[model samples]
Target: MQAECPRQPPFNCSCTLDNVVWDTSRLYLIPIITVDCSGLGLTELPGVLPSNTTSLLVKENQISDLRPLVNNEHYRHVADIFLDDNLVESVAVLEGSPWLFNFRVFSLRGNRLSQLPTYALDNALERNRHVVDIFLGNNPWQCDCLFTPSFQVNTEEG
Candidate 1:
């Protein structure tokens, strides 16, 4: 079935779904458009995201898994994502997702994550070494040899 575009401003730069807005202003020569759906108390990832979305902000929700991103085409253009303060425990959903290679930032500062898939982390870090900024602090992280070796730590805080 064909997906319908959500209601948004006539600027053709945003799509709204169930009170969630997917910003696409970057396509109109405006400031970088970032889809901000934070603090919505949502339990599942939204079904649709515009392919033009550059930054996705879905923090402070109840989302547990990220597999839905792989099921849609919108994930390809995403450069950054903010999923902090959620219920995410496993990111194995993103194992073979090509989007990891081009990500500029991925924040999961406050979640339920205790472990990450090693091979996925290694592949993402190696391919996008100088560009990706991954944040995984304040979670129930199991500090072990397997987890420690793949990721780099930032000593300073923002």
Candidate 2:
């Protein structure tokens, strides 16, 4: 089953769903195109997501792998992704999402990551990467030989 987002009034912002609980089916009909699915207690992302989505917010959930969102064509255009509080252990998950070429802002405040996963910043992704801020506070900051020893995390208010 497929539903098209109409381009007219009176029915411009309309959506369809199939028995999704826990605020999962709420962002469908809104014509905003950008949806933030953060802080909703979502263990994982819904299998069926809007193809035209430009921004996705899946912060403060139980998500450990953001690789699921990399498959869609719209994932590249996503300007901002908030993963401030979750069980994420590595930004290596970005490896799965190539469309994440030039993210304007990113947040991974609370997670299990001991240090920034410099291993994840390999080729292709390191070329056009331009993130203004990447919040890595509240995680296990271990200054060891495993991660980037020179990687200094900044947490200034913006």
Candidate 2 residue spans exceeding 4 A from truth: 1-32, 122-126, 145-148, 153-158
- Lowest lDDT sum, 10 consecutive residues, model 1, at 1-10
lDDT of 2 at 46: 44
The numbered model that scores best in TM-score is 1
What candidate 1 gets wrong by more than 4 Å, as runs, is 1-32, 149-158
Tens-digit per-residue lDDT, 1-158, candidate 2: 13533223222233334233243567444333545565666666544446545455667788787676577454556566677788888766576355556676677788888866554544423554576655677988787765444363223243
Candidate 1: which pairs clash? Answer: none
Clash number by candidate, in order: 0, 1
TM-score of each: 0.72, 0.63
Backbone clash pairs in model 2 (N, Cα, C under 3 Å; residues 3+ apart or in different chains), count: 1
Model 2, position 19: C-alpha lDDT score: 31
